[model samples]
Target chain A: MNAQQLCDRYAAGETEFVAAPLGGFNLAGADLIGINLTRADLHSASLMFAYLSRAKLAKANLSGAKLSGANLNQALLTGANLHNADLHGASLQGADLRSANITLATLLDANLIEADLRGTNLSGANLTGACLRGANLREEKRTYSSSLTGAILCNVDLQGANLKGADLPRANMSGANLREVNFRNADLSEANLSGADLSGAFLSEANLSGVNFAGALLTGAKMERVLMTEADLTKADLAGALLIDARMAKTQLAAANLTGVRLNRADLSRANLKNANLTEAEMIETYCARTDMTGVNLTNANLVRAELSTAILTWVEWRGATMPDGSEYRD
Target chain B: MSVQTSLGAIAQTFAQHNNALRLRKLIFCACTQRWESDRTRLEQQPWPQLLQDLYYRYPNPEALGDAIFGVVKQLNRQGEYSRLAQIILDQLTPLYGENATETTQFLTEQTQFFNEETQFFAPTAPHLDPDDPDTTTIITIAANLNAMEQNLRMRKLLWCLRHNSWENDPQALLRIDLATLIGDLQQEYPTREDFKQALGQVVGNLSRRREYEAIAASILEIINPLYHAMFSPDPNLGDALPPVVMVMEQTPAATTIQSLETEVHLQTAISPPDLSEFPALDFLKSDNPTTTEYDLKTSTNFTPAQPPPALQSPAVKLPDYDRYGVRLAVMKYANPLRAKILAFSILNHNFTTDSHEWSSLRTQPFDDLLRLLHEEYSTWDHLVEKLTATAAQLEAPAESTQAAEAIAKAMKPYYIPSR
Candidate 1:
């Protein structure tokens, strides 16, 4: 049926559009519940506010479609092309979006609770305030993205993404890719980011309290003034990174790479930096109270005006490094 | 002190312990409630500490069992003899040989009693029979029991090693013998060939040993049931899993080729003829090649204008007041009954907002709400006891149940199922 015919049917209380040939249709705000539009070409269609709950739209072409405020709960849209689609305020709870091409899609304020987005291309998408609680975003490329507060991005991709100002508090982003991402002002408290990649990321002033960055990468990253209280950056790479004025109270950066990094005025209170590298790094005016820098490398680095009270520097390499009191390195 | 006073003191101590438990519960409840109202506060809270603390406190076999028994006794009052009897028997298993035999016996007895007396607390419902072997719960319980048994056996093995009992067994010495054999084989072959031969011999020897077979069987039994669960047929499961990333590096030759094309196009357009009129280009028209080269070099040294500082830190903190206000407003309109149910559920499950467990609980099927509620009630009871004890220091009267109820009421609005 043509777009107008479908619209006529929908207006007659016919919510089901099974095997309907409404390709390239603009049926915005049409309630099409339980529609079977499998393999239909809805390319560039405007289905905003359309109720397509439990609809079978598998392999459908919805590229560049406007599906904002659409209710697609439990819908099957596997392998569908939703690239650059506007899905703001859409309800996709328990939807099957596996292998869908959702590149550059706008999913702001969308409800994706328990949606399966595995192998989906969410690159350059906007997911601000989206509910993706329990959504599987594994192996998806989500670069250049934004996911603000109320967005459940637990176990989501973020590797190589620019997530500046993203709110991911209480989200389980464990085992995600966050390499080279910018997370300034992001709230990632209670988020599970264990085994995530954060190499070369900028995380200034971000609230990362209770985040698990264990075995994560932070090499060459900028983390100035970050609140990382009780976060785990264990075995992370911070080589050549800037950590100026970073608050890392009770954080574990043990065995992390800090080679050539700047830590000027950074707070390392109760932090574990065991076996960390600090070669050619600056630690001027830094607080190292109760910090574990055991077996750290401080070669050719400056520690001018730095506090080391209750800091463990045992078995550390201090070759050619300068102390706060202008003393030459002895070890 | 009289027996009644002694009992009261014990109850008070239990209450104190409960208060501590409740504080932890409150933190988790607050997290969920806050998330529902305003997720921004999630950023301010310390989550990792909360998770670690929860992991350390709960699910510790020793602590959990003891705590459960203590709370159960404190909440229920009957003759002292029955309670003391229960305590003595419970403590005996660990004190005796640390064997599962006594513990298993006690657990079995309790399970039977609870199963039979369940109707006393609530109306009788159609029960699934374990002997029928057709029910899903029965199968699940059986699987759990099997896994638990295997875990207990492993624990025993570890315990034996710690106590140096392994040295007493000739068969246990096989591990050392195997190591020595591998070392000897390495010297003789000194290569993969030798390694393979040594491995073959070890495999042959292990195949002959009943212990090795038993160990292998136990491992398989424990893992087999989980195989289907891990690889469910649902397409959603496949979608939830992450994909692998591969980084491809471009070679210098390829990179140079790409840049060379762009540079050549630009160079041809800006030839010496086009610049001959300008004073700066006069050097390019000179017969001396060195002057032309110098002029070209000087022209290339044109610096671009310095851009504004894009990387500079923001001078002012972004106000999250609006988000907080929105959340508070939401809480105001929240349903109290739902909040109480949600709070109770959270408490029962030991849901700490800062914990991975709470997140996991949120993902559970809606059908399991009753189970979740039971867990929440158990947790709430503990929390109330703890709050009462802590409030004792304050001069003003404190009612822990009332506080808990209020919290529940505030949190109800955010407790709706995603479905």
Candidate 2:
């Protein structure tokens, strides 16, 4: 069916149009609320500014569809093929996009709050500056799922998004807003998170090995038992972050801010800490054997019993800090 | 009986209804207490005063006959003679004689197509016929479906039957026509529990056909609105026409309908529609464990092979699927198709064009080859452009605009006009 016939039938209160062959039809700016176009061939359809809230387009072929500025809040797009679709500035809040093929879709500035995106293949998709608070991008266990692996998520707002156990390896998430995001048990190894804001994020037991956190903000982040081996954190901020029992051996921290960071029992052996800030940091019994601490600031830091004697400590500012020998440093 | 109570009771029986003002106006035009010149003036007076003027002023047989005849004439002109005919007859028989043949004859003669045998309009008669409507009425209604489809109430009834999917037991369905079904509804299930039990029987183990399952889902969708309207304890929506509710009110099941809402509310009480609120249709929602990805039903199934995990946090709030038909349809179709497409893609991963499995994937009836092609091509626009170029090469002379006009156009210096 073409756009006109669909609209005419919709106006006549006949909403059931499942599996319709409406490919290449330009249905831009149509009010098709509650429309049941399940499994429809809507590929390459121009649905710009269409009000399709609560629409049932499950498994619909929307590949390459132009859906810019459309309202798809609470839409069921489960298992849908949205490959290469342009959904720039669309509102997909609370939409169920679980297991859908959204690879390479352009979703810049999309609002996907509380949306279910489990097991979706979002490889090469652009979600720049999109708000995905409370959205679920967790991995599906029973399938060959790689949720957002290699996705471009620059400057995207992912606050409160549950990406637990997600496979986001090699994903480009630089400059993204990841406040309070759940990355627990997630595999983000070798991912570029440069200049990203990760304040209050949960990364407990996450595989952040070889991750690039250069100039990234990790303030108040929870990294308990996290694996950041060989990861770069040059000039990255980690103020007030909790990294208890974290395995950060060989990780870089050059010129990185670590003020008020809690590092209790953390494994920082052979890790670089050159010119890094450690003011007011709680480093109780943290392992720092053979680690570099040159030009590091340790002012007012609680480093009581921290195993850092074997580490290079040249030019380290230890003023007003509680040393590993139970003695307070006095400039 | 008091006139107001009698009116209210009669109003309850109206499958189709009108205001007291129209009834009063018909009585006014029919009443003979006022003369031909006095009708225009008498109609201006209030109904309370007119009621006194109509009954108290006119006690003679000639005046009563004139009033009844006038009302019948006006009602006949308005095409409402059949609806109010029984009311007039009931009122007249008590005041006049038992065998009021003159009024009956006059009433019958005034309206040509009254067809009092099917007294659907009679307030005293049962709202639903004890059997299905005659074949002629059904056929006539079927013939002019478009015209009759304007009546949503009628259409919903027809839709219920169409979506019920009687193919499993065609004989059973054939024997149970619409009217007969409604009539049987009066006697078959005395309580709403029985109705629900029958629905469970129908929904749980009905049929194996995919079409039937789809139809069942739609029927369930239709039932939501139908249920609320039919079993609503109070007519709170103020809907002008409520034929189903009216029919239910006259049946024994109506008494049990008072608690049906509470029962439904309990089932849907827990979570909002994370994906959908069609929990009752769980059979359709759940992925069949026995089926492989190739066996998955919906062509829309782009589902990952992975089983769904629990929500990481309780902060995620979702809208209910029962909020609208679109949500319901989404939820209904979301069931049972989560793991197949990935399996299909994996099976076709080797991409051996000459292989039997690869050929099967292309020829499989349920498989979406276009989508697979779309995924490979990246975008349909690119595919179309490539096809158009190929077509250009094939039909170069017949279809190419470039060959027709652009060949002679001048090539200006700064004008690469690819635009």
Candidate 3:
């Protein structure tokens, strides 16, 4: 069936288009709300700015389709093939795309608020500036289930997205824009997020143990109570960030910028902070036991009551910084 | 004294205890509600000191239980019972065995009762047929589900009130009417889909609101029924059965469910992941890299990006005997062939004669050996650059990243690090 026929049929109250061969149909700007197009062949179809809200496209073949700015709010796209589709600025809020094939799709600046993406394949997808607040990218129920496993989300933008409880282990999200993203309790262990821009992100209590944030921009990020044990934050920018009570045991923050950062009561035991900038940073009562802070700039930093026993502070610049004692480092 | 009056006196005593001069000023470090400011101090207190503090607050065991129960109730309003339970259990641990105080025993009994009752219903709906002749059973089940759902919703709302980032208005709590909420939930959830959709909304709201602890707690609620059914030694374990069973006799559904419980136990025995069974979120938050890595490696239920499992393919390898013993028998179609093939390809890529690749193929039913070969080669090629960099790091000086990379590379299946 052609796009025009489908539209006419849709207007005539026939919503079922199951297994319909409508490949290459120009459904651009079509108003097809609440339509059921399950298993439809819509490969290479033009659906730009179409109003397909609440539509059921389960298992539909929309590979290489043009769906830019389409309104797919609350749409059901479970197991759908949306590979290589152009979905720029599309609204997919609360859409069920569980186990959907969204690889290599262009979803730039899309609004996917609270979408169900469990086990969905978003590998190689360009989601620059997409809003995925409350999206479920969790693994399927049962042990070792298919999740966002092997998904390549390199350079994707996920700024301001709420990824609470998201399971993104092993997903490549390097160089992604994650500013102000809420990743509370998200499982990002072993995930490759190297060079990701996470400025102003809220990552409290997130499991980031094995995350590779090497050279990532984390300026002003609030990572309070985060477990970053052995995490490689080498050369990462954490200036003005809050790491209050964060556990960073043996973490590598070498050459990282931590200017004016708060580490009050934080555990940084045996952490490698060599050459890190701690200018005006607060470390009051912080645990720095046996930490290697060689060549670290501690100018005007507070270390009041902080445990620095057996710490390797060789060549550390402690000018005007507060010592573990009540006295100043300079004094 | 009344419970309220006694609670006030106890609160005042607790305040005095807080005011005792330690000369050390504590800092509030953790952000948001997830932080427990007194965690360090409370955890460090000796048993005698803890008991003295408790004695100062309440004279008798009943009073102590009452005080603790009051706090538990308050926490329960927000579904924050788990943390409170942990704190209470910690405080009462020294009282266990012959040294057990009357207060501790009462608290323990109350806690166990609370746990059993609260963990009554799992998130998954019980099997109930609407078409059953016994409408009474269906009605009872529906009523119980409604009550449970209402309780969950109320807790969620209370949590929302506490976690609301916007203007904190105390009036929000006043707006909730328990009766009205129960009435609303009682309005027929005839279909499981409707129930699931509603539950999804509740969880989605919790997630969006950044109520992560609540989300984790709710996940626990889902697993609680199964956990108790499989593990709890209580003979009266079935006392908390679905309301349907109370009204109706044991049927095929009940029998099948029992068998399913057994199956769950068998699966748990087969895999150690099941042993760490607090909830799925507990596993997620666990610091054990091996556990998380193992979990990541095994997850293969919905590989949407890849082509349908070559299980159906005429050329795919089908083992004459299942490798995982009882696990294979349980999961039925779970194929480890691909993971094995990928591992083999990675270790040994070069073969002088094509016979090595073909002979390794064994009973594999695929004529498209080239397709398999291409997939494995590309994965290896893609990983080579990263692996080489890691290898370089290993030579320079052993760093955490290099070690992590080596471990990740080892655990990674062929499908991951997708190109």
Candidate 4:
């Protein structure tokens, strides 16, 4: 149907317009509030700056649609085919895009604040510089597993977002603000999270192996049992973080500030922690064999039962620190 | 002596006393952690290259052989079997014939020989040796004095004390020596007497027991002062021997040290044990602390192992909500805006002044209006009755009763059919 007919029907109080074929139509700056466009064919349609608040577009074909700078606040687009859609700088706040096929979509600079994207297929989507703060992308409800697998989320602010069980493997989230985000059981393996702020984030049971956390601020983050083998955490601020039972073999934590961090029962074998400040960190039962700890300050740190055999402790200051056998290593 | 003779003498000395504490210290100092990589490469070189490098760096054959033997022993201690075997092959092939079988046999025998030599030179417990208990205290004092004599400054001071005169010495040097000028250093330094007593006791023990070998070793420490004095720059010190040497010449200590040189010379004459055979020596000697020390170093210092996999926390599997069920559940809560719009149309088109439901709906809170609608209109028949009754009350004589019918037609499509 043409844009004129849709507008005329909407003026006549026709809110039910399911399965309407409105492909390639210029609906720019249109007010379609509270309209039902369920299963509608709006592919490649120009919905730029359109008022789509409270509109129902469930299972709609909006692939390749130009929705740039559109106001989609509180819109229900569940199971919609938004593949390759241009939603740049669009306001998707409080919009329910659950189970939507948004693969390869350009969500650059989009406002996704408080959006419910649970089980959304966001693979290969370029969400660079997007605001995903407080967005519920959690897969807590099992059937719809929300994932950003291989998505470019660089410079995105995801503070307080629920990303539980999300498949974010190999995602480039560098400089992203992930503060207070729930990353429980998320697969972040081989992902580039360099310079990301994950402070106070709950990352328990996350598969974080080979992840680049260089210069990232993980302060006060609960990273218990995180599998971080060969991960580069160089100069990262993990101060006051609880990393209990983390397997971080061959990980590069050089110059990282682990002050007051709890790494109890963690395996940090062959990790390069040169010049790292581990002052007062609790590392009971930690396995640190062959780890290059040159110039590390373990002042007042509890390393009780820690196996540091073969670890390069050259120039390491363990003054008054608790030894592996529960005895203080004085001076 | 010729270079060959000197090298032979050095090799003999090293092989005989390879396990001595003093030799161990020298070996460890030469093969420090800094030179470990260089040492590894050096072991891979051919026997001719190894010999030439050793001789060129340390012209003293005795010191060269000792250093090489130290390297070999250190490699063995470190459990570098491949490097050790390669080095032994390089050394043995040149000593024995170029026959592969003979060289292989000799290499195998050398391992056992070195182990036995290590055990033979091991220090015994103090209580195990009857003479050790009585001599240990004096030996310890003499050892401390020996250590002090090894100091470069102490060597310089001993030389100065022997050459410098109290009145003729420079004023600055004389002031420090002035204290010693009035009071002998023996009287000024408290430990001086202890050293002298220990030295005297060791000398006496050697002379009475006729243990010329022990005397030869003890007198080396005793003549250290004379050795330092020989290097003095005093013009008056001309061709004259140091005072301690002159004193030792008058005693049996000189003969003991002289006998060592003669004994080494005699051994050189005997066509030195044709190491070509390289007979396997018993290596089950239990007293060697070198092996134990090496074992402790490698095990405690840096045994690299993989981290255990049991540290990973069990992953929490989130509940996967069925999409259809989730959609159905979400539909249970009618949108408040839609419900309010429908309610407004109902109140505008059909409302009765006498109906209890209309009065109840007006009295109910705005937030509870949806609950009121759900509770008031449970069945279609009940909803129709209320609409028709309200329509009947609002109908004028000229107007048709079509307001209730219009309201039902407007809301029919929005309502979900009950199962």
Best by lDDT: 4
Per-residue lDDT of B136-224 in model 2, one digit per residue for the tens? 22222222221121122223323333344323221222222232233344345443334433432333321222223223222222222
Model 1 ranges with Cα > 4 A deviation:
A1-155, A159-162, B1-419
- Candidate 3 docking classification: incorrect
All candidates in order of TM-score, best leading: 4, 2, 3, 1
lDDT of 1 by residue, B277-301 (tens): 3211111111211100000011111
Alpha-carbon lDDT of model 4: 0.57
Error of 1 at A157 (Å): 3.5
Per-residue CA lDDT of model 2 for A1-331, tens digit only, reads 6689899999999988899999999898798999998999999999976889999999999999988657798999999999999877577889999989999998765667788999888988987656687899876673655477788887676878899888888888886768889998898999999978798999999999999998788999999999999999987879888899999999998867788899989999999998788888899999999999987888888988999879999877777999888899865
Superposed model 2: Cα runs more than 4 Å off: A139-146, A327-331, B1-419
Once superposed on the true structure, which residue ranges of model 3 sit more than 4 Å away at CA? A1-8, A11-13, A18-33, A38-51, A58-74, A78-147, A190-195, B1-419
lDDT digits (tens) for residues B12-85 of candidate 3: 44335543221011101111112121222333444334444554444222233344444444321222343343
Candidate 4 stretches greater than 4 Å from native: A141-143, B1-419
Instruction: Give the Cα lDDT of each candidate.
Output: 0.48, 0.56, 0.53, 0.57
Which lDDT tens digits does candidate 4 get at residues A185-260? 9899999999888999999999999999987889999999999999999878899999999999999988788989
Candidate 1 CAPRI-style tier: incorrect
Q: Across all candidates, what is each one's fraction of true contacts kept? A: 0.00, 0.00, 0.00, 0.00
RMSD of each: 32.1, 31.2, 24.6, 37.1
Task: Give the higher-DockQ candidate: 1 or 4.
Answer: 4
